[model samples]
Each structure stands twice: as C-alpha cells, then as structure tokens.
Target: MTDKYVIPREKIKQLESLLNERDIDTLLIFSREGSDPILPFLIGEDTIHLGAALFNKNGRHIMLTSKSDEKKYYESGIFSKVKTYNTSMAEVFLKELNEINPGKLALNFSLEDAIGDGLSVGLYMMLEELITKDRLQKIEVSGEEIIRELCSVKTQTEVDCLRRCIQITNDIYDEVFTKVKCGMSEKEIGDLFVEGMKKRDVINGLGKPYDYPIVCIVRAGLAHRSPGDTKTIPGDIVIMDFSVRSEGYVSDIARTAYFLKPGETEPPTDIQHAFHTAYKAITAAINEIGPGKRGYEVDAVGRKVIEDGGFPTVRHSVGHPIGRQCHDSGTALRPLKENQDNRAAERKIQLMETYAIEPTVIQDGGLPCMLVEENVVIREYGAEILSRRQEKLYLITCE
Candidate 1:
C-alpha cells in the first residue's frame, strides 16, 4: 500500500528553526530494524526499517541505505536524496560526514526521556572511534528535545489514526461488556479482549499481550499488574486498562465494571460514590488542559477532586502524552513533588498534542479501586475528549 502519512512541511520548518536555535549543525538518526522511533515520523513508511536519515540546519534531509533497501526508499518518495552502499556502511557514513563537515552534530540520546535514547552505547563507541581516526570535529550532543517535539506533536494523519484506534478499543469494550459474566475469571475476560483485537486485526499498543489489558478483579494496588485467575464475584468492581496500536499510533483507555449482587438492581452507595468521584476527577483534569497550560497545574485540578471526595490520591501522574507509544514522551500532568524528577510535568502543554487523562480513586478498608481513563487532544482553546467516555460504571447483572 502507498504510504498515507507525511510530516507536514511546516512542521519540518519549525524543527529546522529549533536545530538552528540549539546551534546543532546536523542530526544523525540511525535505525536498525526499526529500532528508533523518530525515523517513522520523518520517513512515513515501514518498508525500509534499516537506514540512516541525515537532516541539516536548512531542514533539508537525505537517506542512506543498503542496496537491498534502496528501492523501497526510492518508492517512498519522501527523502530529498538517497544514497546506497554495497559492502561497507561505515565507509559511506564516514564519507557523508566528511562531506557535510558539521561543526556540531546531534544524535538520538537522552538522559531524561527513554524514547529519545535509542542510540546504543556500543554503537556510540564505534562511531567515536571512526570520527577520531578520521580526525574530524567530534562535537556531539543529545537531540532529545528535537525528537521529543517531533513525536509529541500530532499531524492530521496521526490524529486520525489515533482516533480510529480509540474507536476500535471502545467497540471491543462494548462487545466484551455484554458477554462478560459474573463467574468469569480475570484471565478469561482478558482472552476475550485478545480475540477482539485479533478479529479486528490490531495489536496491543505496548507491553506483552499477557499483561496488556491489566485486568483487576476487585483488587487494589499498583495498576501495572497482570490479570490472574481470580473469578468475578457479586458486589465486585473490575478495572480493565488497555491500549490498541494501529498505523504506528496508540490509544490508551480504562473502564471499570461493577457486578450487581443477587436481587440487587444497582451497586452499593459506596461503590457508586467512588465511581462518580473518579469520573469527576478525570473530567475536571481534562477540562483544565489547553495550549500554554502547565502540566502540574492541570494535574492539581484532578488531584483536588479525588482528595475532596474522601479518597487517597493516586500515586501515578494524572495523565501523560499518548502517541507513538502508550506513554509517549512530552509534558506530563503530574505533581511537582519535592526531591522528585518533575521536569516533564513542569513544561507547558503544546497545541495538537494528545494525552491520556486517568484519575484513580483508591478506597480504604479493602474496598474496590475505581479508575477512569480518557484520551484527549490539546486544542487552541481547550482539550477535546477523543474516547467515548465511560460516563457511568458498567454494571453486571448477576443470577
């Protein structure tokens, strides 16, 4: 199929401005079997996964690949120029560097963001040796900020892909809710989700399939645990947190289901209260997001709601940017706690960025944990909720 994604030229221009401002004369992004995340944003294709893209201060770019992958690179029609090497990629790479002779070169490496740290230490050492042998200028710096911005900001095509993936996840949940019984085990319920994704020809956005849909059977603690054989019981609240990957984009969503006790038409008052409080928290947090808003400020809006509702504040962030990865790198809606790394939460939210707002309400005395997660896109005025939100709990009728 022909590629349907493109990094808008305007965005490329902005990236060039950022490189110029940082005094980075050139950037070198190397990928081995699609290891680097930033390569997809620029190349817009998965046909040739092994290659290198070089971008200069002028926003112009070139692609270098082996003879085997050169045809696909030409088919892409995205790169301005393409160079093919027969035997020695090292020789071609060294020749390119000598020709450009950049004063300051940037590579994909970061200490703060894991997504920007794709370059391996072993490869770095090899590159250093080559540069030293050639007696070339070796001013190397990390291109974390540039890669972060490129991956965080969504193009129209990316936004559409995310929307489709979210809709698929919603549909799967809607179908699973109708089939789930009061006696079903958590693992059984997770199997239904796996079948749904397979039927729809989609895959889990992150992590392995065994734990992708973190199924909680009336259990409370950390949110990343795997689903177990615990069977669903009456008066229990089950939380299903999952993500879907499609077209190289991801959507994260979570919903809670409450099982009705025998002869009971609805859940207990305490359960109802916890569910509403979590829903309210996520709603308020999403409303607080917009262009130029700080991440911590938005997090406080949701955190306060949970506190006022007589529940313990969640240990994790209220929300985080979602895109190429489930927890994509960018500004995060989190508190600036003392002696903690809160730099991601201190930055201002950018326009066209997407986030997953999840507010958790943990009850004391072994009561069920309530959590509601929703996806949103940062707009010029405010945030737009992309998922068909879980307005109320999914109540299960029991015999």
Candidate 2:
C-alpha cells in the first residue's frame, strides 16, 4: 500500500463546522518565506515563499502566492484555486478577499497557542496597511478555539509518520549504546550518534540549512553541566539527550550511563535510590495514562513519586505531543495541578495524542542528577512506550 499523509478529512470538516459555529465565515492564514508550519496543513504545499490560504465556511479553499512561485504551486497539486501576484500583489490579495466577502474572518494569531502566532508582528502591520481600517473594524478576530481544534486531532498520516519516527529513534539509541566507551569525549559520542542517524538516512520534516539537530541536553559532571572538552572519566554520570526527525515528526530520547573502574566506589546509594524512584515514577505515570484522563493527573503520578522518594521534581513537563515539529503542538502532561496554577488549565490530555514521558530526579542540593525520557502514544489502555531501551541505569565498565 502506498503510504499516505493521515490528517482525517472528517477532522477538517469538523474544523470548518467549528468556524461556522463561532460565527466565522472564513479563516485566513498568512505567511512569508514558507517559514510557518501551519500553511502546509491548509494549502497542502510549502513552496510558496509568501502566501495566504483562505478557507470559507461554504467549503471553498483559495491560496494566494507570489508570481515567482505560481508554477511550483500549480505542480504541487494541493491547493484548489491558486492566485499569483507581483510587486503590487496587495491588490490581488484584496481582490480575492472581496470575492469571499466574509462577514467575519479568522486569522492565525493567538496568545495561548504558538502555532497560531505564525504571522509576525511586522507582517500583521503590513497587512493592516493593505486593507482600510474600516474594513478591519468590521471583522471579528479571535484565536482560542481555532488553534485548539487545528492541532489537537491527529490525522492518520501524521500518526503513521510519528510511529516511524519512534522506531528510527529507538534504533539510533541502540546504535549509540553499542559504540559508547568510557574514555570517549562527550562530543565524540554526540558526533557518533549524529553519524548513525545520517547513515540511516533520517530526514527531518523541517529540513535543515536553517534547522539543525538539537542536542536536547548533554551533561557529564556532578551537576549534569553541558558537554565540554573533558574526556568521559570513570565514575562520571554521562547523560545524553538527543532526537531525530522524520518528515517533520520528531522523536526525543535521553539516556545516562555510569563508568566504573576496578577500584572506584560503586554509585552513591542516594543516587541509585533517586534513579530507581524516578524510573518507578515514569512507569507509574505510564500505567495511569489513557483516554479520558486529564494530562495533569498523570503528571502528578510521576511528580509525587519523586517528591516522596526525597528528590526534587522535574522542572519541565512530563511530556508533549510529537508531530510536524519536534515539540509538536498539543497538550502537555505536567505535574502542577489545576488549583495550584492557571497553566494547568491548559493541560488536558486527550485520546489519540502522542507524548514524551520524561521524568527527572535530582538529589538534595542537586547532587547525582538523572533524567529518563521515552516517547509513547496515548491509547485506550495506557501509554505505549516507543523507545525500547528503558534502562534503570547503564553501568559502563572501563576497558
């Protein structure tokens, strides 16, 4: 069977209905340089360096682009109606808008969601100049509901890409474990990991030249400091956090190893205890994860475990959705409860959502630091761990 991009057509229909329910007659997405990820979802192609996508409640779709990109847009086979313009394209854009004659237009700009903020402040100012203040005044603008629906639901193609991303990430972790040695510099290990990924021909959805692989975190010291020129010494807790991208989908994983010498003392009891506690917390959270549960509730499972075990809770969210972007946009699994902070109000874990269940435990006064991360898809039963190498602790013996 030919692989397909899985955004559900029904979901798109639902989004259209949502716009109508909110009294929005049309949704307008503006972009420059094809820098925005949202444009691909609406227009089906990312070639337009500067363009706008308009979706009307009447089920009509229109895309406007620069004349230079008209040929590419036509060949893309994504947009239905394409309009091209030159230096004076403002007139072309306005003319298209006049055809729609929307009573209410929705623009992708929101304080709550970053995906909706694709239109830069400068671009917004330029757009305001193109249309009269009177015309703008008549349009009602908002973002709360629009962004929520656009990103929350996963299309089949997106889910498939994410699944493949997870498998590739797991394979890379295995490769790293095999090549790791006690004396290798942190950079050497990082370089090897990147090389392994390239050998596999893994390409990110957001292709580079502009985008680069993120070394999520690399620490080799008492405090998990950034990776430096220092060689990996026996008894050091070497932590490496890395990710690989596939078709815009991202997979994140973190692993820590201990180098032990013949005479070196074993890992500190406190440090060992903290690692086990954090691992148990992660497992417990995964057990409790499933459809119909709040994201914060699952987060608390991991947080309370670390606190009760005498370690500081992790500073970041337990996990986030994986999609077109590495930190694909969606709800986060977090520890802070709704009553404790307003941010929790935004943490609602929904079904068919993919997340990274990463739990970190730090010793009192920040002693032996450790972080464990894994990707999982939220299903009816619970979270399905994507990365197969979930070691409680990796013991590396010196050669």
| C-alpha RMSD of each candidate structure in angstroms | 2.7, 3.9
Expressed as tens digits, the lDDT of each residue in 1-399 for candidate 1 is: 115435544446656777898889888877777777666666654424347777888756777788777876676565677888876577878788788888878899998998788877766676777678344345787889988887788777678879889999999999899899998988899998998998898998878643448888765433578788888888888989989988778899999999999988878898889899999999899888999999999999999999999888877899999998999989989999899887899999998899999879876556868878999998898998889999899999989
Model 1: clashing residue pairs?
Answer: none
Q: Best candidate, TM-score-wise?
A: 1
The deviation in Å at residue 324 for candidate 2 is 2.4
Model 2, residue pairs in steric clash: 5-157, 6-155, 6-156, 6-157, 7-155, 33-49, 205-247, 205-248
For candidate 2, give the lDDT of residue 253. 72
Tell me the spans in candidate 2 whose CA falls farther than 4 Å from its real position: 1-23, 47-50, 203-226, 263-269, 335-345, 364-366, 389-391
Models 1 onward score TM values of 0.91, 0.83
What's each prediction's clash count? 0, 8
Deviation of model 2 at 218, angstroms: 9.5
Error of 1 at 86 (Å): 3.3
Q: What is the C-alpha lDDT of each candidate?
A: 0.82, 0.68
